[model samples]
Target: MSEEGSSYDWAHKAFLQAFLSKSVMTVDEIKPILAAVMSARDPNRPTLEGDVTAPLISSTIQAINERLTSVDYEIRSTKDQTNKHTVYALVNTTSDSLTQLATTFTPDAIAYIKRVLDCMFETNNTRNREVMAVTSIQASQLAKAPTRSRQSQVGGDEDSSIQAEAAVKSLTIAESEKVLADLFDQDFIYKSRANYYSLAPRALMELRTYLKETYNEPAGDDEDEPAIVRIRDCDICREIVTVGVRCSNRECNVRFHDSCATQYFRSQRGNQRTCPKCKGEWLGDLFVGERAANKGQRRTTGGRSSNVRSEEEEEEDEDE
Candidate 1:
């Protein structure tokens, strides 16, 4: 049902208020606050807007009541005749039910519901999304890899396009996984199977359970901790990180923590990157004729430096 404010932010604010007060609040009390949050507008609105006509408001409340009822969320409405005020109180549900509700939503409500639920309940959307994305990629890949019988068909444009889509899907999955892997060092932290790396299902389940217990339990005196970023320490600067900020060099595929490498590369606009350790131009010929000079010599700074020194020594001998 349509409401005055964006449902996502509104619901989050409502959840927080309900959690802190240790008491149920009325719908009337929550509506204006939620409306303001959703819009990110000044909280001092002249008055609550929308089809706030009694019937429309009742219908919207009823819709929420019905949705909440399926998941065993208790909601009550009360009006104080003397004060001329109305309020809605939302009671918490069991942790299991909350997790289920957060992860599964109707397509129409998915976007708004996800934001609200994530902010309030703290579900593992990253893992959930990664699982869904990877499964989709696997399905696409399985559908491709044409059977031996189809190899003879040369002009299969439709098949080729389908295969291409599958390839793209696989790449997307890989990229998403890489981001998480780099952030968490999951490849090293967890085991790999057939080069398909992942944390154990039990570990992920534990993470989900801990997050739910930590965030969704009864309100308490302690403040919650912020989200953790997982990254490796930089070799040069030795800064801890969840993901490297930039490559040590474009060709090296070596990454470093942002703080460690920021001084060297952050100011550059483009194509002006250099090695973090050696400060050599990424593609410059440090070994001007090394390939011709020594067939077996590796293209490395030490070898290039020694070659330069050798050349200078030979020129000095000629001068003598």
Candidate 2:
């Protein structure tokens, strides 16, 4: 297990023991109880055993039962029956639940984690250029549209010419401009600005073929490279990082290919840093689910009377 996880495990055990000990439980009292329990036990030990250790175990367990009994009437009534029982009896946690929690974060937590990642990835430059290329294409569409319009006006019956021009302008073929443009237009593309895009969640994934073709790196293996590798797909383009690189954020262990990282970071400038998966703050924790949901609920409820009136009219029209 990770060192931090180990510490939390020790802390959690101590907390349970201390929390159960007191005649009267108060918020301020928890820390000291925790401190006492931790002081008595070896922090590194996964399991505590032996006859010599029995008294400490019993004391801690009794304290927990007492505290739980005070809080729950069911426990209070069953308290006598569990007097000499093992400490594990009072702690009701499933191994599966604990395992799942350690491996996976809740949706809200994932968002929070992503926010921090977004900030770190936004620091790259090359990736930024790619993003700008796509945005420029979109914004310039009106200007480009006029050219098509002019051509159509001059040659109304020449559908083949129009198709050729469209094929040329679209990034589908081989030109860098159209290729970049189409890549940015994908829903998986999250653009921070004119020159930035990211391969975020709810978007397409980077293909192996594209990576091999665009980046000089080979498609299969990198035997010469160090065992420790940092690679990330572009959050906007769904392009795999061909360049060797790692996420610069010390706190975050994410890695990305140089090109992919650059695009992700550049797209993040003057924008929010968020993980595409969890949307969590890379540096801190912030829960926005409740607020967002509440706002949505308010919007849904606000125009209800008008919506009802429209629905009634539609039904009446059908009847007529």
Candidate 3:
């Protein structure tokens, strides 16, 4: 029970009640609730002036803050010097709370994972390369953390080897693989494959649901009128191919400008030229598929063919 002499204690109780209704509050924001607490005040003493109430409010807030410190909770308040005010939040500062915050996958993490998927798709080398790409994203995130506070030493700056680059595109493929090792241990994201990752079934289901409910921007898409646009790119030269020749493969729509295709074919190991991405030869993949399967095994200089290693076969050999 608050003593009759302490108006601040009464105000403290009222502010606590106000905190239940809001996650955060500024001094001005909670004044109305404090004012209402004064409604039951005895008229015996002269009413406290608005200027007099200021110190009492500060005292009441300080009392609650002191109590919060004794527990694992804190009344975190940040002052805005520019605005000349402070905003406060009740925060749980326990180890469990810290662990939860660190482990939860943020939206930015999801975006980075998406970019990794896009990178793999672009390369068409969708091998088991989780460590190759995911680790980079994690490293990039760590590098972005306040390096001064991130130290392992007593007085030195954090020894983070990963340097935070301005953009994800700037990161090399090797760094992505490094950070992915941490994400793998977390167990919320990756799936067990032949040493590669796609996504766990749990993550896949959640992402599918999120996309259907949040990202299906199918409303305005149907009503738009179609417009003719000259869209082309030279696959070999990688330019805005204004003039080009398409690969002879029917399924391949990739273009190469006049002399570019000739030069591209000329650089081929053998007489045949093929689509770089699809591995389609002049016609269909009639012989291209067999050739590609063997190309990795066949030596260009020597006529000997090395055995192609299967994901399962490699694991079996390692066990022996």
Largest lDDT belongs to which candidate? 3
Each prediction's RMSD to truth: 21.7, 24.4, 23.4
How does each model score on TM-score? Answer: 0.20, 0.20, 0.28
Model 1, residue 115: distance off in Å is 43
* lDDT of candidates 1 onward, in order: 0.36, 0.33, 0.43
Report the lDDT tens digits of candidate 3 across residue range 1-320.
13432434555666677775665567777666665555445444433334235555666666777776667555555432113255555655553332332444443343345555433222212111111112233334433323322123345333332322222233234444443554555332353323334333222222333323332233444557433212234576443332234544433556564566667777888866777767877432221111222344222344434355553443354342
Ranking by lDDT: 3, 1, 2
- Which parts of model 2 are misplaced by more than 4 Å? 1-186, 193-195, 202-208, 219-320
Residue 186's lDDT within candidate 3 is: 38
